[model samples]
Target: KMHRTVLALVNIFICGCFASPPNFILLFADDLGFGDLGCYGHPTSLTPNLNRLASGGLRFTDFYCTSPVCSPSRASLLTGRYQTRSGIYPGVLYPGSIGGLPLNETTIAEVLKPMGYATAAVGKWHLGVGPKGMYLPTNQGFDQYLGIPYSHDMGPCRNLTCFPPDIKCFGLCDVGVVTVPLMHNDVIKQQPVNFLDLERAYSDFSTNFITTSVKKKQPFFLYYPSHHTHYPQYAGPGAAGRSLRGPFGDSLFEFDTTVGNLLATLEQTGVINNTLIFFTSDNGPELMRMSRGGNSGLLKCGKGTTYEGGMREPAIAFWPGTIKPGVTHELASTLDILPTFAKLAGATLPRVQLDGVDLTGLLVNRGKSQREEMIFYPTDPSEMYGLFALRLGKYKAHFYTRGATHSGTTPDKDCPVFAVLKAHDPPLIFDLEADPSENYPLPLVGRPDLQKLLDRIMKVKAQFEASMVFGESQINKGTSPELEPCCNPSCSPKPSCCHC
Candidate 1:
């Protein structure tokens, strides 16, 4: 009787494991702009794979990120809350920084793990690398992690030469202050990771993880945050000279093919029908980098500012037969990812106040997005680390506008109007549906409806400000040279230190 009972239990477990829940793949691009891809009307960048993904799936026109910069933007995406709520506010994290993603916060991986989903986080994880990777993806909930702990340009060990011999890795010698360490789980796999080969490496690692998950008949979540089209662009060998845009386009071109490779992997693994793939950017492009930084399409300004171009991102979702192929102008934010994932995986969410609403209706049923309003956070100094903008339906208002416009910072000839930082008395409001560029602010002289709309938006903003509670500011915890990752801490200064 005992043997029979054990056999029955084993059968039940096996059946449960092979029930085949849907898989998820989140392809997060670093600093990709709203108009950077070909599908988005960029005459050059030539993002074919992404265009194909859009043709066969759902494309979002008015999607946005919570923050306009790196650490904060990423924080909101994973936890479905504002960066201020997650403590990743004010600025990006550095190698010497002490703070990281708080352990108490529940991530998407943690939410799905209980439902028996296998998870992996690949590529740039700027969330945190504090205290010997105590704040890494593995600690936060991912089953396995293999990638850089912070921004690619934040360290040393990047190759001096890229695929095209003409392009050189400038400031490499000076960048030796902090080494870009490649990590797998908690161990530093390589310091000063080869930037040129990172995309290929990430693609290979992701496909392997996918293959393993399918073999086990386990649903998986692969969060692939790419490091391409950022600063100091470097395409892998043979990936250069493919785009009409300069080196930036070259890197983007290579990244698009990387996406193609993932698609091929999905098809080859026979999980194409079951997997749901989402492609989006962490934030808008870095217009400070000028031409190399990427264009914001028709939106205003770029990264590090409270503008439509700064927060708006190009988002695409593909799920074969599950999600119908079409484009939607629904207002969506990265904050919605967590709740949406929870609903899709049939998993319960943590007991916390969430900013993101479930986007499942918008994704599968072609229904409207649950999110109605979005609050944009500042990426400037600690003093300006408050709400920068607000979006309600078709209207967007800027409470405090700052960045790039400040002359000496970085002259951007693209943005003809250089408005310096200032608080708006009535608040600069624009109907995004009519003016996507945010070029024309609706005049209040003859429009009573405009005044009413502004009042409503201001009321929501005031209420949000009055009730919102912020976590401890981890991004401003301060930095120390000792906190930097070192593969071989013993080596000396002449280019050999921290190299393994």
Candidate 2:
């Protein structure tokens, strides 16, 4: 009955022959916090474009990423499975990491590309890039790709005075292995990419893809994962020190403008009505950068933890004619993107245990979210891919709680990084709807009324654990010199290494 109902809802939009399959543009942000945008309540980081986007589209207050860090979170977003299920566990993959997201695990691009969609990917491709660059986005079903294979800040900075002073690690300062390659279709175009010109380059890449695809009358999917609001932040041309909230705000302002430019291109090309744009972050803020990092709003902690602040993101879904504009507090995740896009393209899901519930109904008709519960995976290496927290309805139970990596010892008791490693017996539960800050814990030791809730949660957890078949450990496979994206094997490093 559920399957039949889902098919019926899908037919309501695609109707008859999947007429005019909508274009999908997933604008994924890097380390953007919930409170980073004015729409989500950034007091000073004035985000006019993003604010306008939320006003004109649907905003999700309770949206999330599957994991709190880069590679794992991206894996789940693309595959619609938990990061562990896809073997991107134990935190993010480094530049020369030998392994990547398993080739067998199907991605959103893989699902859509075969359905006659001209797929292009831009910005950061952090999932993995090694083993002869076989793990890059081009191999993962994208027809065209441009940008760095990993975080731009992974390599040592040439100069720190241009970046935020609070930035802790000046790009793997000691090792300095990641000389980020600016690649286009697996070919290196630039090394140690000039960040200053990144905004203009990205704009040209995305707009050109949109324009060319439209001219060919091909439905397109552009997954533009941006490099914004992360460490070593720099504003785009004409965007520096403009937000008045500091350099972080400056970068955010430029990101908003970049998005605005895409929207304009869609409008100019007369495809705005047929485009489905999902704007969200890969994970939460990086708290180590202090003022250079993003704000999690009322949520606890930041990147590299299971806290809401680490995983929860600001989400906006815009479709000019189809989707009704409004705010939804219903639970959603980046995991749902694959299933939802599959449903949109009339494609079948890959034969595997997918952890996402399609949000087509909620996205198109303002119906209730298909999801009721959420499982939070630990992003901190110490926790080792364990289930850190569970959210059943409004109540969230934290089986284990820890702080972000490099967060250091702090006097802030509200931060909640315990000195000792003792698992909770009863589990600290919170009514997230009421206390979004996670300051007050609902003591479960003596509350008989909460026993049933806990039981229900445990039952689900047990089921998840029982059916789990974790994929091969890709991240744990140590980095190899063979995986580095050095264009010339003979050169020393950048500045002299492959300039062309």
Candidate 3:
């Protein structure tokens, strides 16, 4: 009877039914790749702090982000729903874009707020920014938000024309050309945020929030989505020109150092054992940036494609006394964060259905992951919407194909690869467990059994399509004429311009 009682309590703890709810800190990196960190086998890009986090916690080798780009992936992470279902689908939100993650969708922040958690979002918020700030973090669920509203490269750049009317169509830009404002809550704090110490600023804000939460004895959730490793990469303070991997490497070193600082704060505040930290990237590298971009290592392709490198990201979870230090090849994603956090915080799931699975079981090494399969959506929606990939167990099947070079001049076009997919009788299947690089597609010449795979793939596709019934799409033909970004506007302020 005593053994049975102990076993029951163990089960409760493994399932995240804690007597005291633990704090959460989700450290999200922008455009950091699967192989860019020391623990992930990057020969360069020193990530000692991240490496330490992994050493002291669990690392996921088969983890993924829901999409190959920013906003969609972020939406999935926050809502535990596919971006397609969340209505931020198919494409990313730009500065001043009116549409965003549907207001109806419940975010992880909202889930925890009811549980008495103080939440703060610090860093890039590409979900949406509108005239009344409809899609901003404060409107969503965050108690406070301090950071850039979008990617650093959104503003004007000297190398290319990144101003109004035309810049919306061209997504390429450099730092000096435009000033990306840093915001506090809904208001702009620094117009054209100074890039040199941006990482430090975010780190300091995160640490300060952690300190205050500790003082108040309130559990808090800090969403620190970094702005480094994205295009127009800038070195953080004390890290300029400090990497053998060049500017990109320099930025990573500083970012890792910032992580160390946050960890130190958590330790100093005596919350290290009670806090859970998730370290991962929003998506893979922006290969267009070349040396300035991240390395995907052995994985084929980088950002903006359905390839493993694009969606499969390096992830680590740390909770000193809770999760045992180890590695797992479990299928998990940013989507799982919400459900996992909800369970850990003793909160109820949202009313709507979610695509993510609760990861507490896997996190505590109690059982296999709840997730069995994942559907990969293409980043570029203009080409075709039917194109999707299904990952089941060790195999993945792509219903369509795209050009290999996403960093090409016209990255958005379906170019060189067919604009519309050719009829694939067998579809392209790769055994991911064996071919993580996705360099070879298995031939279906002799195997009648392959039909079973096709049938299963079709079923997955049908379910995904059916799930879209709940979606309230916010995608635009392009950045809406009225919703064009205002702050820069070599154009005057209009009523429709966001944060003008």
Candidate 4:
């Protein structure tokens, strides 16, 4: 009888060890502002579904994107590395845009695909497109791709004017001049459709993918990168003029509905308990001309610069019976998603260094905080926005490029009015606990210890820049035939070695 019991125990252990992993559903909203959601405190905005999600699971108060833009941020999220490391430092990638994710860099989908998870990316895929080898989603790792190659607003529109009034008509608008054709794999599947209808289509595709996976009893990873609340402000037919705020708010409400529909579908299918849903934005809202849709509240600066408004985003993870609900003020980045998902899927990644660390433990444990410090940099060159900022606890330091000036104005030109002279140059430090808004800069007087902290931040910033330069150089060497002809035998010499 004792021998029989031991055999039974061994069988149970083996069964448990070979159990299937949980499915993953990552919902990424395009250009959704931090204050757009109701749970994140939008007095006029309504995000009932997302609010419910926050109540049901975890709401991260201080979550951030790696960059304040799309492509770079998405690249970082997928690879779990800084964009600079993967040569994805920039604004949105055009069809023929040169550099994308390096071939050597592995994505979360690639890691999970081998682990038996069916991966699909539905909605916006702003990484890249066209002839570039690294541009396609299929090349990256996604098994199925159904989404726009870039932002919804990238397509030709009837009106190319500013927001609030610069509304673009769908079918009436001129196509080739303003918008690019929507792509499926490498082919142009359709001309740009109405923004509202496009979203619904995205929802339908996502729902179908999830339902099919559930029916098949196969674990799947759905990357739902949405194209809501971005621009060309037009909510669907039924949702138009629903919000009191404006078209932008109306669009946000529609986005909330999409989230609701997705969640409800999961629950209805009885897969909510076995699925992990992550929701976040590509960056902070565009606070300049597109201020109608964005709300930075008390945070300083807006999109396109390394500031609270630019990088700090609304992040939440919902996995019923798994993640606990409530606010977590831990410092987290989009880069953390790759490693976190990999861990949950029980997948192994190639031996490549990634800047982000897995925060699965912190997500599961209520009291745990993941990051001690984070570095942020912008890739835009128009503003000559060569700046790096480091956040180590409360002390934050902004290191400007040699001749670059600091300014508060959105898209400011002709030398920053707020530029401080070298004599008075000092790192702007704030006690975030007391001043989350960073309204008042800390006085540099009397605190020698604080000065030392600033110095350390600068040192770290220097190291980061050096590493980026070195990586770029290596990529150049690899792509350049003159530099090394034997290195790349089939090399046709792309714009950047990083494109490989």
Candidate 5:
């Protein structure tokens, strides 16, 4: 009996010694530009909470979202792979769209849940919906999901005949409007409510979930993807005309408050130190409403383009004792989140192929750069956008049909349809480090080595494009292979790192 008692004490001690892993909270904002936050640089933006976070955590200067659009960006973030790999290669889906995240692809939540983490997603879920296998958040591995299936502006307009009628006037249109009912798991819990209130409600719900999880001694993963500052911007009830910068600015302030509330909740629950919080935007600002959103400072272009404004974003990671504070100019992408989270949680990701490299080392180690080269592609065919952009070292080469706008609102309508015989384009190279805004395209007077680098970039681009096509083909054939482990033959080998 004494021996058994001693063994029990040892077991209890071990349990106490091995505390649960830190909880994870990913706070993602929709349509928030890199300069919208006070930390990143906003002359008039009041983001005290986010500013505090920057002062206390690690801020990334060169972080890029996987896509320049919403749906694809989220898909990339969730899967830690290019959205094209999962067949989400364009604008967000409407209710009838058959495309959503493929079921075969594993999500971070799904991978972490089995490791004893309580996973919950409390915000926008634009991946897909309806009778399709892709509609439900539960199907995607989220234990709890509470948000709209897509963007707040996706519902029918309050007045069917009104061109871009006040979406809030009718409040959460289920019929002619584009926005749908708020969903809880598979069920629509609330029908057609104001999206601003919906956002606030989700914030509250997220806080409550975190509090409950902490009480239960369960490590939790909460994905709070806010619909703040997105198009048809609507602030909460009392926040109308609250900012001098218009609806967009008002929406940003409200979003900041929501984040403050979450942080306060963490402190109240005594889990602030035991939590890892990541904050970033889905993509760059929507250029259609440029005044509504801020710029990426010197970064050129905004939303829908392959430019830095469209892909680069303000990224911050906060873990009291884990991630050191201060600025990190490392080139990191949204795709790195998955593998990083998995590593933190001691979760094993499937051996499926992925384009993202685990950036845990970069986050934990202040002096390391996560990647040396990154390729950006615009899957949207509308703008006649570039097929791919290769960022190697300081040089960025954009390879695309020069004249295509890919849905861009531009004065020039007609241009060349010629494909580059070689990936190297004399007019396409830009030294980003020297010209971050891409203001000056480098004069390729006689630089053959630069041309070679561009050629290599195109070769890699071809390989990736082929991979995307093959993945899509597999998906269509219903033979989409499951994600295997990183070391598995099915998975791609890790990318080479650049410690610059």
Candidate 6:
């Protein structure tokens, strides 16, 4: 009797130690706009699956990405720290960029690794490219990786830089001019994957990962970062010309179907109620693409600007049994994802201070948002010193003004409306609650004019300046000979690194 009791106790303890935690599927879209999804008020693009997910869970209307571009926003999403703090400050990583999310930073995957969650990173991983294994996803806590290393357009374009100055040139002259290697964990699975099949492959990888993880009885964290809707728009087979909006719309449609299938997989595994799913974008659409560029709806400018449209990404969180289905206008940023997941998984947050707060309460319908403000920075690939926008409660104050007529031409510094009366000297304030589009600006500094606002801005700026240390961006850093994949059948660089 004693032996039986001891065995029972030991079994209970072991099971308790490895009990199933909630699975997380972070479905990240590349350059998807706030107004692109049907749930977010897009008129045409078929995103039924995403809309359905939103209807089943909580949809956030005013959710923002940390930056107006990709790598910085992704870094912030993973670490719950500003890109400036995470060392990806100025720009996006390129094809063979040396620098990546610093090893010191504790990623969300790393935090959940201790809980025995099976983690996989699928699709685009613009963080870094490698001959060195350290920059790959496996080293960064992901158990498996199957995807492209950077933006798809980075491959050789037949036309000028593969941007295709004319829409007619798309898929004709310059699409997939350069070959992007298909990475499977640290090895190059395919020398150059056909762009036409990219979307379907990503979907297959994701669902397979989930299926395998479930079979192993392991809770999983699947980071599916789609590589569509950026530029050089190529539609995967069966998705071509499917949307009325052209290639961009086709990509959206494919993504929606992919989401639906993923949800279906979760349901099939009998873990739909235990899985936490998130659908959001790295940033807004690329307006430079003109007709091919996505509309930001009522929001100001598109990607690369600090306007609402640039930073405000469409976001949806779904956990069938946990989150109540409702739309939240509360201010939320991708930065909050880390701490929220930490709390959900009962994982330890890093000892260092973090920018994001725990949003588990809001997720559970327990309380209002703990976040009240957010700071907007200048566009990357430009001079750093430019206008900064501060959002305090309902009022958004811009210390400097830029003549942002459209997406790309926003000036590097504050633009002058007059010869002497500099518009930004007193700061231009807008009531975002009244004007979500940021059309009209309240008159410059008046009696008690933004004194509190100025004080708050100064305080945060001072703190940032005091502690912030800028890291060298690896953008366009020449691909080192050592970073090249070992193509020889008999030779391997390192067993842990990439082997062709």
My TM-score estimates for the predictions, one after another, are 0.91, 0.92, 0.88, 0.82, 0.82, 0.85
Per-residue lDDT of 309 in model 5 = 73
Q: Write the per-residue lDDT of candidate 3 for residues 241-320, one digit (tens) a residue.
A: 66788777877888888899999999999988888999899988877666767877778767777878788999999999
Q: Which portions of model 3 show Cα errors greater than 4 Å?
A: 1-18, 159-178, 381-387, 409-423, 477-500
- How accurate locally is residue 369 in candidate 3, as Cα lDDT from 0 to 100? 94
**Superior candidate under lDDT, 5 versus 6:** 6
Q: In model 4, which runs have C-alpha deviations exceeding 4 angstroms? A: 1-19, 132-134, 159-178, 381-387, 401-425, 462-500
Q: Write the per-residue lDDT of candidate 6 for residues 180-218, one digit (tens) a residue.
A: 568889887765555666677888988999999999998
RMSD of 4: 7.6
Which scores greater on TM-score, model 1 or model 4? 1
Please list the residue runs of candidate 2 whose C-alpha ends up more than 4 Å from where it truly belongs after superposition. 1-18, 160-174, 380-385, 406-411, 414-420, 492-500
Best by TM-score: 2
lDDT value, residue 278 of candidate 3? 95
- Quote model 1's TM-score: 0.91
Residue clash pairs of candidate 6:
156-177, 156-178
Candidate 2 lDDT score at position 388: 76
Alpha-carbon deviation at 78 in model 4, angstroms: 0.8
Which of 2 and 6 is ahead in TM-score?
2
Query: Cα lDDT for residue 324, model 5?
Result: 76
- The positional error of residue 157 in candidate 3, measured at the CA in angstroms, is 3.6
Model 5 / residue 284 / CA error / Å: 1.5
Task: Please state the error at residue 60 of candidate 6 in Å.
Answer: 0.9
Q: After superposition, how far is residue 111 of candidate 4 from its true place, in Å?
A: 1.3
Q: Where in model 6 is the C-alpha error above 4 Å?
A: 1-19, 159-178, 381-387, 401-406, 409-423, 444-450, 463-467, 471-500
Per-prediction tally of clashes: 1, 0, 2, 3, 25, 2
Error of 3 at 341 (Å): 0.4
* Predicted structure 4: lDDT: 0.67
User: Across residues 99-161, which tens digit of lDDT does each residue of candidate 4 receive?
Assistant: 556667798889889867888888778776534335668888887787767766654465532
User: Over 4 Å off in model 5, which ranges?
Assistant: 1-19, 132-134, 159-179, 381-386, 401-427, 455-470, 473-500
Instruction: List candidate 1 segments past 4 Å from native.
Output: 1-19, 156-159, 164-166, 170-176, 381-385, 405-419, 493-496
